[model samples]
Target: MPWVFLVIAGLLEVVWASLMKESHGFTRFWPSLGTLVFMAGSFGLLAVAMRTLPLGTAYTIWTGIGAVGAFLVGILWLGEPAGALRLLAALLIVSGLVLMKLTSGH
Candidate 1:
């Protein structure tokens, strides 16, 4: 339901972020178009999720997922640094998301 939409939205956030990097400040046509499409889809799904989930909880989880996903993409795909501290920060963001999920009654 809403959670499904929320997850999809978060994933789309990652995709759009990657596309944004690929877009080269929107000079590249195809990646720029893809970025716009996914950005819209992500926002739409986030709005859908907000109908049922608490606003802060849903937003935090969505951004958390996007941040972690984008960071991994940066390291693995784009050759960004995979330092211990960076990895640890990513893990902590994920842990926070899990803790929020577990504690929230919604």
Candidate 2:
């Protein structure tokens, strides 16, 4: 299903973003390669999903997943502070994505 592909693409967005950070501006070798691979895969799948899904809804969900995922990784693994407000903001992102999906009428 297109939704399945979209969700996978969204998760790949997260992986690619995290790998991009690990890539050290593409200075590192392995992480850089991984970033490229995941980035391609993410976009490819997103395009597939876009064949049926509304463009704005699909794009918002993709970036929302990437943003929330990267933020959580920063807090949990990268030593960024996990403050209450930060957590709330992440929740807000998810909430917005859900509303968008619901109202997209796809």
Stretches > 4 Å off in candidate 1: none
User: Which pairs in model 1 have colliding backbones?
Assistant: none
In model 2, which runs have C-alpha deviations exceeding 4 angstroms?
A: none
Clash count for each candidate, listed in order shown: 0, 0
Predicted structure 1: clash tally? 0
Local accuracy of candidate 2 as per-residue lDDT tens digits, 20-104: 9999999999999999999999999999999999999999998998899899889888999988999999999999999998998
lDDT, model 2, position 16: 88
Best model number under TM-score: 1
Q: After superposition, how far is residue 90 of candidate 1 from its true place, in Å?
A: 0.4
Model 2 poorest ten-residue lDDT run: 68-77
Instruction: Please give the CA lDDT of all the candidate structures.
Output: 0.95, 0.93
Per-candidate TM equals 0.98, 0.96
